[model samples]
Structures are given as structure tokens and as C-alpha cells.
Target: MALCEAEKTFVLHGVEENFRIDGREREDYRPMELETDIVSHAFGSARLRLANTDVLVAVKIEVDTPFPERPFEGKLEFFVDCSANATPDFEGRGGEGVAIEISNTLSAAYSSPNVFDLKKLCILKGKKCWKVYVDILLLECGGNLFDAVSLAVKAALWNTQVPLVKQIDIDGNNVEIKVSEELYDCRKLDVEKAPILVTVCKIGEHCIVDPNVAEEQCSVGSVVVAVSEDKFSTILQTGTGSLHMSTLVDCLQLGIKVAQRLDAALWDTLTLECYTCSTTEDESDTTCLDNPSGVVGGVTDCDKKYCIIVRVDYKDPRGKLASILRSCVDKPTYTNDVIEDETHRVYYRSCRTAKCNGGSGRSDSTSDDNGSLGDKSTIYCPGIGDGAVAVTVSFSILLFAYAFVRYVR
Candidate 1:
């Protein structure tokens, strides 16, 4: 739908006020949530959500003959899929145009050898080399897809786990590669110098960062700037509007500054292995939402139930009451309950619930006075079998819930 004159005027006025419709300054960005190592089946994977925009990236490695001219280097290919989930207009081949545009831009950004050293991926000169395929799935489009996709792709590569090459045997015209049998004996991709793209949207001669859907619709033009360790790697103009040389240079400078900050923040989050979740660093699993089997505590378990709990320490009465209830049960199955008291207001829901009958007995409450449930928390199950399988299954659910509530918040 087209925006009315008054709405447009309001947006323009807001921009003049140095604040956009989303209550953010022109240079401010929407809240971004990132998770790496999400797709286990792939070599490396990451999921990035910037406000309403959701992007998933996976990297797959394959052996292939190197190009005759570039025999010493490997190859990197980008493929983007604009899923129907992003928008009904993207159903089937409808999103192909946008997908191609995004993929092409990514390819251009990574084409420079300095941005990504293809030589590091080569298994052998001229004959065989590792081909890295970066596949991006767009789940939702809230705007600023280019920036989000670029960040996801970089993060996925950072989390990529490459198998260790034990030996390479060449016989006649055939080449054979031996991979390490030990799972942990893998090589991690070097991504310390990965590039991050930032989109600068020009609205009424003013530039902005991380524009939302509404803002994108109003912007006349945009410039995508890719920066690696504060160096400008690539710059591409987008949209139909024309930009003067000086304005384009100004936008590029701003984009580089923003990208440097973004890259640092992303690296910090990626390296953070500790979380409030119940699972230890060694036990945590990573899973993506697009997979048929839901990712539970980062692990792919299609048949199991998973829940995410957010704790609010606010002094609102409603929040305090909900926290109290969550603390009482090992797993809070009552999602509809909204408790209000004099202290705080809270919103909590049951992500998943499974009914299992076990031994008939009431178990002691394992929660604390502060409404915190520990990792060893348990619930009474009636008619549950005494076998190890039953016990393991039951405990896994509790552990999943505990970890979900702890980390997802």
C-alpha cells in the first residue's frame, strides 16, 4: 500500500528530528541476534536475525578440479534462496530476481582474494581443491537483507568446521584424499579478517544505517559497503536513484565506520562460549529453525519437545508472580498462566510439552526461593519405566528446558 502524504510528511519530519519512525537515530541499527554453528550437517552455518529480518547461511565443501588459470587456488560460490516464508510474493520463482541480486552482490564482495584466501582451501595444486558453497535461506524480509545476509555468510564461514586431510594419494589420473576419522580432529576456518557489509540508505538526501521495511520504501537509493578489518573491500550502488560523487563518497565513509563497529561486535558475540544456560560448553548443541527437526539446546531432535524461558527481574508484580510459578515446576507446562502481583509483570510460555506417565509419587520441589531451577531439577513422573532409556529421555527433557530458559533469554 502506498503511504499517504501525511504519513510521508511525518516520516520526513521524524528524519529531520534525527530520529526515524523506529525511535532510532539515523546511524543507529536495529537489534541484531546472531548464532553460529547452527547447521551441523553442513561444514559451517549461522543464523542472523535483525529485527524482523531472518537469514540462515550454510557452507558446504566439495572436491573439484581447479580452474586452469587459477589452479593453485580453490573456489567460493554463493547461492541464495528467497524462501516463501519471507513473503508470499517470494513463493516459487517469484523471489528469484531478489535472490540473484543478493547472490551476485555477495559474489562480488568475496571475489577479491584479499577478502577470502582461496589458496587456504586448496587441497592440491592444479588437480583437486576444496570448493566452498555458501547457501543462504531467507526466512523473513524486514528490510536490510543485504547487510544481514552478508553478516550471516561471514559468520557461517567463521564457524565452519573443515575435515582434516590425513593424506593425499595420486595414482595415474586419479586423486584420492584421506580424511581424519576422529570427529574432533577438524580444522577451523580462519575468519578473523572476514568482511562485513553495511547498507547506507539515502532518504531525502540523508543517509541511514539498517533501515527497516518502512524506511527502505521511503529511501531513494542505497549503497552497500563491505569492510574487512576497517578496510573497504567492496562498494556497490543499489536502487534507481542517482548519487553525486561527493554524496556517494560520504556514504561510503559512513558505511565503513559502521561496518568496523559491526565487525567487532559480531566477533565478540561469536567468540562468547559461555551462557546462562544449564548445559556445559561441551554439551551444547546448535540447530536451525528451518530444519524439520527442531533444534533443542543446539541439538537436532525432531521427536522431542523444547522450550525457551526468559527471566525478568523487573519489580513489576505480574512478572514476579510468573517467575515464582516457573520456579516451582521443574518444567513450567502452564503457558497460559499470566500472574500479576505488586512487583513485576512477566510473559512466559511453554515452548513444548510432552506427557509421560511414570511412577506414582510426588517429588520434592527442586526450585529455589528466588524461583531459579538448577540443572539437576526433576519432576515426578507416574508410570514411567525403570529402564535407563526412560530415565534418560525424561531427564533430557528437563535438561533441555533448563538450558532453553537459561540461554534463549
Candidate 2:
């Protein structure tokens, strides 16, 4: 929607005052909701809702011959489909332009080996490699599409589980490849150096990190910076507006700072998401929304950085609240953010990658108010049966019974 002269003035004044229509500061971003593993058929999948803009990402893997020149690296391709329901402009081919732009941007951002090590995907040099197809569906486009797309792509890749190649047999010019059939016996992509894209909008004498639809309409130009760790991987300028060299420098600085914080938060959320969900083959297990290191038989996405420990001292009378606890909750993850009790102590402890939920890292506190992964016996784990399946199913049920409950009244 085009902003009227008066509306543009209003938005301009807000930027000048450092307060946006949504009460956000210049560098502030809209609150975002991210969920992973939404696509079961795909190797990895994630759905992210940044305010009104919603994006769904799914990863599909296929075995194919590598490029002759770059035999050591596999392939990564991105496809974006902008749903017609997102906006009036997207009703037809109008959205294709936007889709292609985003697709190309992502392509460039991940083009470098230093940014994403595609070599890890190679199964056999010059013969076979895994091709990862990241399919993105844009359900809504509230604004700031580039930033939202980058985040969802990173998360989906993090959740992806690449099938392990067991062996290969070659006869003459024909090549035969064998892949591991066991589920979860797969290699996960290391996204520690994945690039994150941040869009900085230039308004009247000011720049903003996340520009809403109206704010975006009023902007003269925008610069998108893809930050990889502390380095700038790729930068693009959009819109007809031009930036002075000094202005461009400022934008890059802002993009890096925000991207760093964004990377941290993205890692935290990914770790937190994997922590709460379990991976047991049983489809009937109670879905754990937040347990980072799931108990036995549980499915866990072992993309670890910092593990979160939740200590719940059962203060209620024996079996009194079990029935009630099983009935009144709805949302992802059983977190203190949902249930607040003085006895609950939640601590984030740093841990190694791919370790299960029970592995303890360094302790954050020692007293009653603290907990660590090392004190497993001290932590909470409801026993099911001795078998891995039994243990996984039983633990999932007791762990997240509250997360599935909804207040009917």
C-alpha cells in the first residue's frame, strides 16, 4: 500500500523521534516466532512467523553427480514461491520478481565455502554428492522479507538431517551408491558459519533495521548485508535510492551488530527448539516442545551450542496436580515461560555439539536455585521402560503433558 503524503510525514516524524508506529526503536526488530521440523517428508523443515510475514522452509536431498570443476563440493539450491494470498501484488506473476530477487540473494549469500562448507555434502569425489534443495513458501509478506527469509533458511538447514552414504560400487562407467536406511543415522549440516542477511532501510536522514510495510513503502532505498560470523559475506542495495559512502559504512556497521545479536538469538532458539523436541521413531509419543536433550528413545536434533536445564521441584502434594497438569496447556515447549513457580530453576549451560539432553556442561549455580546437566539424577526424568522405545515414549509423555493441554473452559 502506498503511504499518503500525510502518512509518510507521520512515519518520518516517528523515525526522527526514534519511535516507530509499532513502538520500536530504529534498530529494533519485530518479534518473530520460529518452529522447526514442520515438514515431515523433507529432510529438514522450519516455519517462521515474523509478526505477520510467515515463511515455511523445507529441505529435500537427492544424490547427484558433482560439478566437474568442483568435485569436492555438493550443491545447495534455493527456490522461493510467493503465495498469491500474501498481498495483492502477489496475486499473479507480480510476486515472481520478488521471489527471484530473494532466491538470488540467498544464492549469493551462501555461495562462498567460507560461509557454508558445501564440501561436507560431498559423498565421493568426482562421482556422487548430496544436493540440498531448500524450498521456501512465503505465506505472508508483512515487510522485511529478506531478513525473515534468511533466518528461516538457516533454521531449516540446521534441522536438516542428511542421509549417510554407506558404500559405493563402480562397474565400468556405471556407478552404484548405497545409503544408510536407518533414520537419524545421518550427517547434519554445520551452520556455525552460515550467513545471516539483515536489511537496513534508509528513511529521512535515518536508517532502521526492520521496516514495516508502511515504513518500507516510505523508504528511499535499503541495503542488505549478509554477515558471516564477524565478516561480511555479501551486500546488496535495493530500491532506487542511493547511499553516500559514509551512509553505506554506517549501514554496514549497523547490519553487522544486529546480525551478530541475531545470530546469537538464532542459535539459542535453534538449540532451544531441538532441546524440547524428541526423535524416537514412534509417531505416538507426546511431542516435547522444549527439552533440548530429550530422555532416551526420544528424538533430538543435536545442533547444540548452549543447553537449557529446567528444574521443577514437585512441591504439590503426591499425585494431586498430575490430573490437573495434564489438562490445562497449549503451545510449544514446556517452559517456565508458561508455568511460573518459585521452585522452578531454569539455567542455560554451554555444551558440546550433538550431545544428548542429559549430558551436563559447566554448572551455572550450585545451590537450590541452580542446576546443571551433570546432576542428571538430581534432574527430572520419569522412567518408562528399560527399552529405548519405552524410555523415549514414556519420557515424552511425562515431560511435555502440560504443553499439549488446553483450557476448555
Candidate 3:
């Protein structure tokens, strides 16, 4: 959208005064919501919503031949798709231009070996390697796409579980690979040094970090800096405006600082004590998600503490066990079965086991199945602590002005 002269002046004046039209200072980011593990079958996935811009990222890994030139390294490919619902310009191939640009920028951002180690994806040097595909879907755009997409991509990669190669057979020119049948036996991608992109828009005489569509229209040009640790991975300039070398230096410094803070916050979010099952309903899904088949489901970290599940049991007449899954429960309830009405001899067991809520409320379960609920609470177990540690742990969910998001991947 084009901004009229009057609207442009308003944004320009705000930047000059160090206040944006949204009332944020030049350095402050819009409050964000991030959720990971949304794709039930994908190795890893995450969705990010920054005010208005929304992006979904999923990572899938496959065994393939390594590049002949870079035999020791694996391949990582990025693809971006813009949804027609995002905007009219994104309808059909209209959004292809934007998608290509974003994906290309991401490829460049992670292209550096130091930023994301491709060697880790290598399974057997020259013969076999893990090719990772990161698919990004743009659900909406409200400006600052570079930053939003980068964060979402990082989250997805951080949660990605690279399959464990159990066996490899080499017969002359033929190679056969076998992966562990255990679903959780995969290794997480080390995204500790993943690049974080921050877009600093040059509006008037000042620079802004998180610009809205209106502010984007008022800008002369923008610089996107992808920061990894204290260094830069890639730098890009957008818009038709020119910037002085000195101003560009300032943008780089600002981007690095913000990227570092964002990185720390994201790490804290992932390591915090929060977990959930891939399924949101029934006792079968409640079993810590360890069992992808049979009596179990899959497990992952909630954006908060414990994922919400409609734990059901034959004992409970209604079978709607109160659960707050994936919203990041403050603490996982190991065993908290409270009796609603003692007159009926009804015993609603909040199993001491983390995953045994019975697909709940069904009259079919014979209590014998109840014994297996919490046996392996160790499955994907992350944070467990006494009351004191939980106090500090509760605050981890709110870091970065973040709101919790829930998805199954």
C-alpha cells in the first residue's frame, strides 16, 4: 500500500522523535507469539506470529548423496510459499516473487558453515548425507517479514529431530541405510549459532527495527542484518533509498544486539520445563507421546509447561479430565486425582504417570490399563524441579514479551 504525503509525514516525524506510530521505541519489538512442534509427522515445525505477520516453518530430513565438491557437508534447502489469504498480491503466482526473495535470503543467511554446520548433516561423508528441507509458509504479512521469518525458521530448526542412522551397508556402488524405528531416538539440530535476521528500516533521519506496512511505505530503504553470535552472516538492503556508509554501520550494530537478545530468549523458551503430546485428546494421546503407535502417542515441549489434553478414563463418567496442554502448563501434574462427588464411589485418578489419561470418559478401559500410565515419565522429560526452581521457571515463559503457541509436529 502506498502512503500519501500526510501519512508519510506522520511516520517520518515519529521516527525523528524516536517513537513509532505504534508507540514503540526504535529498538523495541512488537510482542510476539511462538509455537513449535506443530507438524505431527515432520521432523520439526514451528509457527510465529509477530503482531500481524505470520509464518509457519517445518523441517524434514532425508538421506541422500552429498555434493561431490562438498562431500563432507550435507545440504539444506529452503522453500517459501505465500498464501493467497495473506493478501491479493500473494494470490496465485503473485506471491511467488516475495516467496523467492525470502527463501533466497534465508538460504544465504544459513549458507555460512559457521552459522549452521552442514557437516553435522553428513551421515557418511561422500556416500550419504542428510538433506534437510525447510518449508516456510507465509500466512500473513504486516512488514518486518525478514525478522519474523528468520525467528520462525530458527525455532523450527531447533526442534527438528534428525533421524538416527542405525545401519549402513555399502555394496560396491549401492548403499543402503536403516534408521532407528524408535521415533524419539533422533538428534535435535544444533541451532545454537543459527542466524537471526533483524530488519532496520531507514525512515527520515532515524532507523527503525520493527516496521508496519504503513511505516514500510514511509521508508526510503531498509537494511536486513543476519546476526550469528557476535558476527554477521549476511547483509541485505531493500527499498530504493540510499544510505551512507556510517549509517549502515550503525544498522549493523543495532541488528547484532537485537539478534543476540532474541536468540537468548528463544533458547530459554525451548529448554524450559514444558512438554506435551502430539495428540490433544484421550488417554492414548496422554501417554507422554512416547508411543506414536499402539497405546501411546508422541511427546514434545509445550510453549509453556504442560500441554493440554482431554484425559479420559472409564472411571470418570464425563471423562473430561481438566488439562491445560501446550498452552505451557505452569507445572506438570504427576498425580492429582481429586474426587468430585464421593457419594457415587467415583474415583477420577490423575495418574502419577504423566501420560495415562485413557482416551478419558470411555466405559471401555479395564482399570488394568491404568497401571501403565506413568511408568516412563522419563520420556522426553525436560524440566523437573522443587517449588523453589519452579518459581524462576514460571518466568521463563514470559521472556521476550512472548505469548505461548501450541502445535503438533
Query: What TM-score would every model get versus the actual structure?
Result: 0.67, 0.70, 0.69
Candidate 3 per-residue C-alpha lDDT over 288-340 given as tens digits, one digit per residue, 9 for 90 to 100: 33332242213322333232232322345555443323223433332233334
Q: Model 2, poorest ten-residue lDDT window? A: 374-383
- Model 3 TM-score (2 dp): 0.69
Give per-residue CA lDDT, model 1, range 1-409, as digits (tens). Answer: 3677788778777777887898888877778877666676898888888888999999999988899999889889999999898988898799999999888888878877777888988898999888999999999999999989988898889777788899999998899999999875677777667788899988886888888877777778899988887688778888888898888988998898777777756654454211112222233332221121343433211222223333332454322222211211223444433343455444444332221111010111211223322111111111112211111111234454654555574
Residue 293 accuracy (lDDT) in model 2? 30
For candidate 1, the C-alpha RMSD (Å) to the true structure equals 16.3
Instruction: Please provide, for model 2 over 1-409, each residue's C-alpha lDDT reduced to its tens digit, 9 standing for 90 to 100.
Output: 8778999999999999988888888877788887777677999888878888889899999998999999999999999999898888998799999999999999999999899999999988888888999999999989999999999899899889888888889997778888899774677899878999999999999988879899999999899999998999899999988989999998999898888777766765565222333322233443342233343434443243333333332334421221111111112133223243554322223322223334221143311322232111110111122111211112235234433332221
Segments of candidate 2 deviating more than 4 angstroms: 273-409
Best to worst by TM-score, what's the order? 2, 3, 1
TM-score head-to-head 1 vs 3, winner: 3
Q: What C-alpha RMSD separates each model from the true structure?
A: 16.3, 14.2, 12.1
Q: Which residue segments of model 1 deviate by more than 4 Å?
A: 273-409
TM-score, candidate number 1 = 0.67
